[model samples]
Target: MPAVQETVDQVRRIDVDQYKYGFETKIESEKAPKGLSEDIVRFISSKKDEPAWMLEWRLEAYRRWLTMREPTWARVDYPKIDYQDYYYYSAPKRKPTLKSLDEVDPEILETYKKLGIPLREQEILAGVVREDGSTPSRVAVDAVFDSVSVATTFKEELKKAGVIFMPISEAIREHPDLVKKYLGSVVPVTDNFFATLNSAVFSDGSFVYVPPGVRCPMELSTYFRINERNTGQFERTLIIADKGSYVSYLEGCTAPMRDENQLHAAVVELIAHDDAEIKYSTVQNWYPGDAEGKGGIYNFVTKRGDCRGARSKISWTQVETGSAITWKYPSCILRGDNSRGEFYSIAISNGRQQVDSGTKMIHLGKNTTSRIISKGIAAGRSQNTYRGLVTAHRKASGARNFTNCDSLLVGDKCGAHTVPYLEAKNSSAVFEHEATTSKISEEMLFYCRQRGLSAEEATALVVNGFVRDVLQQLPMEFAVEAQKLISISLEGSVG
Candidate 1:
């Protein structure tokens, strides 16, 4: 039998690319000038040639952001970020128009291959081959390398389905009507500090729209890798599900190893009209720095969905396991009658990582319902908290919400906290909030070991069982991988 340290060492040798879309596309980059003044913001807006109203929105956000202070309420501590230290836009300088998969740079393709991210529906669809001629996925993918969208797979097929999946920068040019009507509609520029900053200097991100009565035949996924050092990735993703439509979209992000923390403040908004459904999932695996937590990524994000029409539904499922400091809350505004909102999350923090994540459910219409299930795992001096809010307005008659928050502590030195606020004005509204905190039982580990499992294996099994409820909510493609991450994050922990 191999020694524990030796087995661990073998696993340690595995490259970072194992995480799907975890790739490095090293290319000479073009970037906006450092320091974000009004002129810099104007430069970004002008560079993208955004409409007048959008430009005005950016300026307004910049002004409001100046008045906002760096909030220090989080349990984590880090040096203040110098806005001048970052390049607003850093993209591959090449003007290659990769309308299809083949036009993408060979280097970018190779990077995705290392990350195990299938490029197109053909590649991942049903036996598409890579450069080496080996097959991986048949799923469609839009690979965003740095601040540019390099290649999109099966785009023509999606277009035939009346679906639009392109970069936000390209969308403003190609689908201006959709962009004009919906951009910043759900989450405005003045929403929050991070959102305001993202509004001012957003570089590039995906834009997706599924037409009415269309059940997108293919899954769409975006792979975002920020390779530029000292660059702030301000991406805005907008997803619109028209009446009687449905789409499942997934996003993943990763940054290069850096001693100085990089900033990733992205804004994602979803609009589901009458009888439409949108399912959004994210797996964020940014570098979490060293064991001593010298420096990594500060992931402050604002994500929300608006159930605009009766019977609309929006669901957010996230598996967060990385980042030195993670501050994100994906919320839903249930404004339509009988509209449904759901948030299922699994946040894992290890080795000095701190995560303050959860969801918000705002019921503003009659008969609205929401469900929230959160799982937090903390270890190794890390802190994980689930902060959620469920509110029912005065006219939101018959509003209902069910919340179950569970926290699992792997080590004594770590911390896990749950703060939930429930506000209901409608006498007909019904809300239930429940939470529990517990640690793994040594007897369970002993029982697993007695059944012929190793220590690591036993711990992995136990942790999986603990997160089983939340893991079950993930899509099949993501569940197995998320389970492995949860297990690996708690390795060697006994407390």
Candidate 2:
């Protein structure tokens, strides 16, 4: 019994240590005055060198935000956030624009190296070898430190394929027409509270454009890091896949361990034109606070995709493993005939974490289709909820929708809930819904132990299998990291 207990302790410690990216980068930053105000919003726009029209857009959003209230509809419970208490803008001190990987700051390069995200395309393609000498597949990455994009790898390679992949800040200056045409087209500035706030002060995120008939040669990705103390991160991502084009984009985020909670509000918009397809995947691993939930991040984000032309498709896959509180619903608007939308998610909460997430699919065109698969895992004293909606309008003749929500509870103190809403005005629309909740079975554990697996191993194995369906939807590089996160998140559930 003593030996078994010792093994359990060892496994828990190792699992906690797997969050190697949860460390701060010691870099100087220029921060705006702490708080939310008209001046602060203007300051952010001025700092970004945005055009006057853009500033007006932000001010409009700010005005709308003032009239709006923090939504309490989510099942998550957290202390009231002091909007004016944190720095709304923080960027690394002036540094030379990197012309090549060799010109990048060695410290920044080393930071990603530690996170297992290689900045060198050659090294990434050759494969990133772990300390154990195992190699993970190659991936291009845009590293965002605090509120700014520092470097984007494989830009030249992507350019040759007629893909435009760069920081949103750069896109605003180089391709204002494209930015103006679609910025907020999917999620308008009047959308919601958090999104309005983000629009007013968002610093930096990725911008991707896949030209017509050109499938992206490789996956494009962004790695966002938060380092400045008492600073809120507001990043905006915009992706436009032109007619007959295809692109898969991935996002990863992390923050240092802290005792005080930080705020992160972001907005992501995706546009798919006729016959185009876009796949977006995210692995969110921000610090989830200590065991007592003293410190962590409040993640509030608005993500939506618009299928504007016939036969377009957009899919969102996310694995939420961290954050003290998470409130997000990546949605889709199928406005074109025969368009399709999909949402696959795996939300795991442990150590007092709270997650309120799901998706919304609005079918407005003829014969549109949508699918939703959600898996929620709750351990320790955490709470996980799945909230979703599927709406088919009167014009959406022959529309079809299917939804499946599954929850897994690992301990008695944890909780899981599913809330789904469906609305169909069209008689021809077909909607199917299913849900199930289950606990780790003693029989399964006993069988695994008989097969020589430890209690902790058996529990982790079962949880992994439960989420295998959605995990398989993640990009290969992200899948590996997410698997580790799942195993680590379930550490203390077994006796």
Candidate 3:
């Protein structure tokens, strides 16, 4: 029998839920009133102790949000979300002055430890050697528990390198000038409905600024966890790479399992100056409900990058494997002559999940270049869609772009779709787009089975090969984790 057929026959023999990051921690938390109003926005601003200008900004966004409506153009279906039924802010109760990790709640610390995040500097640097006997590269982490930053590692080291890596709230207080100048510069406050909402009630997120002519010493990361029930998580992150600077940033997210659906709306913006570069990566594994998809997270996010100066570059790589309903698009605006942009993504869906994600590349200057590569895998009763856009403005002479979209389906009940848009206003502009959708080949499955591999193993192997190109774009550590997540997400999906 074919390996795929065998896998289908055995799918009903085992019933297992493979989400290991669904455990919640017990901690006392402070929460705002359960509703959205002008007063609630003011309450959030007061909680952060932001300046008057910040408060006014929030109020303006809130007023604008009242006039906006939720978008429904995506290929995803979900029940209407009552904006007033969720807690806007929730944070662990702790002292205002925290000198070290010892002051953080022990239960929260254990939760992160269980999630494999290195919040301790010593543990990150403690005798961890690479295969070549050299110390492995370190990662600076900003841990955001529910609504506030619980801890940030390697502050001193990053400061010594002339890098500013801290929570955005701290940046608002310490480096107000930088924050004021760059905040909402890439993705405006009124960019979309979710972004406008985030601008009003965003709680906490990471902020990074790399000085000119300096390269960040190590990888910078932010880990977000949602633990509170009936609460929404909204974080806003901003990164700026000054002229001749370079930085690499990573983001990861997870949520506890619950019978009720939750909301996660986030905004991320990147700015690269002249001769600068920024590399952004994401590994999103939020809770995806159960086999029947009764409850899960509604992930709506907006992420964009701006190549603002000559010869600047920006790249985005993401591995998305969770979330019951996902609507996200990470884009880049090539506004500088000779600037470059790249997007590589791997999206996997299973067990009634719905994903509609891709990227946009806008060429606004002469000699600009952009590339997009997307791989989507659908299993069980899920639907995956890739929608992308590439456009060269009228003045963008000598612009070039290439896009490729591929999809793989594991079961007859699943679906994969691709929708791409391309436009070139200048005669000198060039563009190319290619897309394909297919299932695992029966001959390949039979060969793997003949080599003594089980049906499940063979399916995983084939899926891995299908996504290898996009996986190679991730960092070494993240690539390994993403590989394992793909296999786990496809388990019991063949039937």
Candidate 4:
């Protein structure tokens, strides 16, 4: 018994040490007074030098947020949040405009380096870093620190392809006409409580516009890091793919460990025109607190995509492994004939983490089609829930929908639940739903152990097999990171 106890202790110690991206970046910042108010919204808009119309839009959203209440319909529990106790905005002090990557703050560069971001290679044409620190061919990156965009790489290359990729703040000023045309077209300001808040106070996020008939030259990505304490992050992302165009965008997030719970509410909207397609992927790894759930991020986000023209398509892929409480539903609206939508997700809840997430597909036009694949893994004393909806309207003749939700358990102390709502108002709509729940088989573990594999290794092998379908949907680079994160999250979860 003593030997077994000691082995368990060692496994736990390793599991607790797996949060590799929890280090803080020490940089001075300018912060707004801690609280939510009209003044704060105005201050954020002023900082960005937004136009009067944009400010009015933000104020209108704020007015709507005031009349709304924080939603409590999810199957998760956490302490109440004091909306007045957090800094609505925080940003690193502005530095002189940068002419090249070398001019970026060394501290900022070091932060990305420690996070495993290939900044040097990404800036060059070749994806390799030579001995002299110059190479080529890598994805473009926009790094967001707290509430502002710090730097964007490969912008010149993307610009040559007629792609407009920049920070949302810059987009608001430089391309106001484009921003005005599609900013709230998909997700209205009145979308939800948190989204309304984000609409009003969102500081900075990525913006991408693919020109007509052009395929993006390379993948555009963003990395968001939250460093300031007592502050909330509200970033808004807008992506538009013009007719016959294509683009793939990826986002990643992390935060420093803190004992006090922080808030993150974001809004993302994607628009795909006729014959165009958009692929959006996210790998979220926020701090999930300690074993006792003392402090972590409370992530409440709203993400939606719109297929507004015939033959348009949009897909969302996400790997969620952290956050004390997560509530998000990335949805798609198929509003044009023959449009398509897809959602692929993998959610992991360890320690005291709680996740209430899924996707929604709304079919409103003839011949629309949609598919959803979701996998949830629960370990320790955590809770994982998959809540999703699929609706076909009266005009959605010949629409088709398919949904599959699967849950895996790592220990006896965890819980997994699925809630799927399907509604079809059109008699011609075709729908299918499949769900399954399973636990790690002792026989499987025994077989792997007999092959000289450790318990953690065996568990990860099984999990990877279970989630292979969704993982394959991610891009190659993101898939590697997602796999490593899955293995680390499941470590020490099994005996």
lDDT winner? 3
What 10-residue stretch in candidate 1 is worst by lDDT? 15-24
lDDT of 1 by residue, 348-403 (tens): 88888899999999999999999999988887788999999999999999999999
Residue pairs clashing in model 2 are none
> Residues 138-244, candidate 4, lDDT per residue (tens digit)?
78889888898888888888999999999999999999999999998888999899999999999999999999999998989989888899789999999999999
How does each model score on TM-score? 0.92, 0.95, 0.95, 0.95
Local distance difference test values of all predictions, in order: 0.81, 0.89, 0.91, 0.89
Better of 1 and 3 by lDDT: 3
Question: For candidate 3, what is the lDDT?
Answer: 0.91
| lDDT tens digits by residue: candidate 3, 5-76 | 334333334445668788889999999989999999999998998999899988999999999999999999
State the local distance difference test value for candidate 1: 0.81
- Which portions of model 1 miss their true places by more than 4 Å? 1-25, 129-135, 491-495
- Between prediction 2 and prediction 3, which has the larger lDDT? 3
lDDT of 2: 0.89
For candidate 1, give the lDDT of residue 41.
86
**True-structure lDDT of candidate 4:** 0.89
TM-score of 2: 0.95
